[model samples]
Target: MSIMALTPPPIPRDGPLLRVDRLRQWFSSGGFMSPRLTVRAVEDVTFEIGRGEILGLVGESGSGKSTLGRAVLRVTDLTDGRVVFDGQDVSTLSKRQLRPLRARMQMIFQDPFASLNPRMTVGQIVGAPLRIQNPGISRSEVEARVGDALRTVGLADSHAERYPHEFSGGQRQRIGIARAFVLAPDFLVADEPVSALDVSIQAQVVNLLMEIKRKLDLTILFISHDLAVVGHVCDRVAVMYLGRIVEIADTRTLFRNPRHPYTEALFSAVPVADPSRRRQRILLKGDLPSPLAPPSGCAFRTRCRYAIPACAEAVPPLAHIGGGHQKACIRDDLALQPAC
Candidate 1:
């Protein structure tokens, strides 16, 4: 690797809204004398999102995208590393300390169906954050905030009176969005927020989210597998493989001039809009390997077509290629085809 590849990306002197430093979330199973197996769901991941910026994380089902998202939000116990949010070292905070911090940082869960409390009315669900964080706020203030959040997501105030079971899939997600937005958080981890909704409904939700972001100037970490949706909403994109971020760059650069083989393969599968144009899909031979026993060197080397013997020597760092673009693969000669 060149010296440039060994060098780390410079953080903005002013700092970002959220900074994840070498974040790792590992799960252990099968104990005692049998030798415990550790699933490195998110391993040594690092990134930053500026104030009002939307950073997209994309990968297949088990690539640890959601796990990374949760780790950043501190929803699950992290095995190692640190998470700094808006100048605060959130990873070091106790549960009691993190409780009040929830108002500034929030998450919009993926499954609208499962995330909402079936028994609670929409108002109760949306107003829960405010009630918990700002104990001094009056009930009327909570109701007002709930109404505003609902209307912001295109829901009526009357809809807040109904139960989750009474709403359609789209409406339930809107309620979820309302709940997350009720705080008007400085940072949002939207973990596949629109994936469970219908395609038509997904478009509406995406539009609403973008609109809200514009109005509120919200900083978001959007996690999703949908590249097309990501290309539309994200300012920058990060691609994950197994438990590592393989590549990351500005949306235009990453989409039009992808640097990693895994990114090339993933983007090639994206369907085109015009019937006249066809994309040559980059198909790998094997399925994604289990994180329990991930391959050494480069975890993607087993399936990466551009893999060299050197790829098996040691894991490549997420190195800066040029112009804010970073790739983990060490090879410098391959000119992989762009997704666009």
Candidate 2:
């Protein structure tokens, strides 16, 4: 089944389920005596995830895709910016104030083994969230919910008695998914959930996530470095470079015609299955620059093939090209045809 066909409708313009405006997440490195340095993990990033939509956050390992996902869910404190979830600005909410909101938002971490506790059984691991969130609920109800959640992710009640070490990577990931969904959260941050699993298991996890999203009407921020996976699962994709969003659009449009050079380079790397089709790989030069000292203007200008003098003058804004597609580059002459 085509994952795109299962995607829910676009987020209504009147109000989005989640809104991130000018989000910046900077980490302070160095001691008080040493020169104070700032690592811009995420900067000036802004986007929206509509209700029941899967928005893919695709980028290189250090491009801040994971950090952006965490920041959106307020898992990490923002350096500067606003995160409005369900019409409330969650950025300013205190821990006590944010307690109730925690039930509505959850995260499925990247590492299944690390995220799951070896000391606890699958039942304990999955039901932990419920025990903390709804303390008044009886043990039978929590166990029933945990069983239901396990079944939802394709695991059985018998599997809940097993420890994390007993199951394979894929099954452990399913446990993680069940834990995240135990609260029936409206928003979920799946940070590279399938990246560590076996190639054969990746598709199963992706399909399970798609099924869960559709069945529960959940909005997800799916973060991954794999463009093929992102293209297969997401409705809309936001391409990140260094610490900023370089391009964003619906899946079909972005795949057919990418505007940003960074995005083009990324799309070029996706392996094509057809032997007859020849794809021209756009080779990006140099390693990703250090976030502590990024380029003055566009961070990607140094590696961009079609970069111009204007690219060094100012950080290009994400301007509309056409059809709700937006790019951050200033150049307009370059044509980057779709490789796939």
Candidate 3:
């Protein structure tokens, strides 16, 4: 059967506002003469985001957190699996079919400077989505919405006339936020929205996102490498390693008692503010494996301290331990120490 013929029907909106099931995205590399290599950017990733909930996708660089976010939003085509948003099965929607849904689902990109068009003024940048999505709307109404959006992100109306280059890094991010929010989206994929800003300004942007989420009743998939930031803003956290979720739980639970070896290592790396409460840094062996040729069985087996012989035989399926906490490790003897 053709890919479109395999598309599932729209799901009920009564459950999670966003549901991604076994989603996979792969990129092909090498010429026809050479052996084709598939870079498994996202593989068998499954999760759900309830309405008005913020689910943080935390992983190190090259862990495919960003790819998973893009795949979920259908910004890129999926190699396999399904993505259901609100009540629609968006996994198979053509660009023309997805046009109407575009306004409801938006993304705040990682690079503020690159994401916004330098040629466009702040007002034009933020108002462009409104104009494209609702072409019949009056220009006056667009201006009103743009003003409100700028104000929402703590930007002044006068600033709207300015170009992206004129703003500070933080200010540029605020402009990006204004652009994403002006569409009045129900779902947003914030892919490292604060990663490019100053440490001092990171908190400010995060706070703005929190405020906007509350005000708009938004369901956000927050993708970031900073566990500290994720812990602060997200209701739940899903830890990804080598394109697969290794552990998932409520923010408090996951941080307090991480189960998987990779998840534990990640949490241990978070710097403790209190010198008295210093943690033993878990230094993993080697760097992240290349996605083009990921190791068989558990992708993390090579670096995982708790890996057994069985870990190399087959990938461990995610299993619930307790209280909505789940881990993919085969070992049952491991658990993260309670946080100080």
Candidate 4:
């Protein structure tokens, strides 16, 4: 069997690369122009990614997946929570203090075009961090390092002289990857890295990322709204809804035997290549509730077909079923066995 097919099934507590606990980020609208409401971008969300593991974060656009990723990296402030990286808390770092530690964690943003500066050459863009981090390093060493990073991401050393707009979408993303990886970051946060690329090009980028992971022995947090892509690259998957993680499991387990209603709905919505063999897609009713005014208990209850009256009254804690599989659902009677 292929490595994708033969790998042992994922269990929740097997191990974690990064651990997040009760994370919350609340933004209060200010002034008369604002609604004077608090937008809870992330609320009491928790999960972990095993070392050298690809833990996919999947959710709808407003589901707070990106926000959670940013918060963990301490790119944004947190309202309440703890982000433990290799057992060290990241939330406690001061601006001046986070410098040395910043080298270990890096992010690949969704919009490659926007993330890169048009004014700077690719070499300068990639080498800038190195310049700041290691001022004493010689110019020749920086040039060599930048060239090596470009080659690692499959771009030629010559391409380092070009600007971001000069390359194709896929190539630009590769540049982003090159910039992020040049630092040799231990944990990489890819926020929808492939979502902006052409469908034909997505696979190439995905494969490149996978290859780099193996060669570099790096751990990654691959965030995306597409289940298909997540299935391809991630070892485990976490499904988020309305600022909270509704369910999380091994990648295969999530696809084959989704335990939570939200996860099941997601799988049901995926379109199959063959129209004749299509399973009925679960169409969620009503739009996602506004984060400023989320439902009291289960945020998904308003749209969940299996939601009960009690679901509206009590928030379901993520209860452990067995074998590290967990779900936040009151209806244990309907839980599906995790995929093997």
The TM-score between candidate 2 and the true structure equals 0.94
Query: Could you give candidate 2's per-residue lDDT for residues 1-340 as a string of tens digits?
Result: 8999899988554577899999999999787889889999999988888888899999998999988988888877889999999889999788888889999999988899899988999999999999999889899998899999999999999888889999999999999999998998999999999999999999999999988898889999999988989999999999999999999999989999998988889998998999899878888888999999899889998998887788888999989888889999888877897846
Candidate 4: the clashing residue pairs are: 17-49, 17-50
lDDT tens digits, residue span 1-340, model 4: 6899888786553356699999998888785987588999999988888889999999999999999989999988789989888777888788778888788889998988899999999999999879988889899999999999999888899997888889999999999998888888889999999999999999999999988889888899999988889988899899999899888888887888888988888877676676577455678998999998999899999999898899989889987777667889999888543222
lDDT, candidate 3, 204-276, per-residue tens: 9999999999989999999999988999999999999999999999999888888888988887888888878
TM-score of each: 0.94, 0.94, 0.94, 0.92
- In terms of lDDT, the poorest run of 10 residues in model 1 is 6-15
Instruction: Pick out the ten consecutive residues of candidate 4 with the lowest summed lDDT.
Output: 331-340
lDDT for 73 (candidate 4): 90
lDDT, residue 2, model 3:
94
Clashing pairs in 1: none
- CA RMSD of each candidate after superposition: 7.6, 6.5, 5.9, 7.4
* lDDT winner, 3 or 4: 3
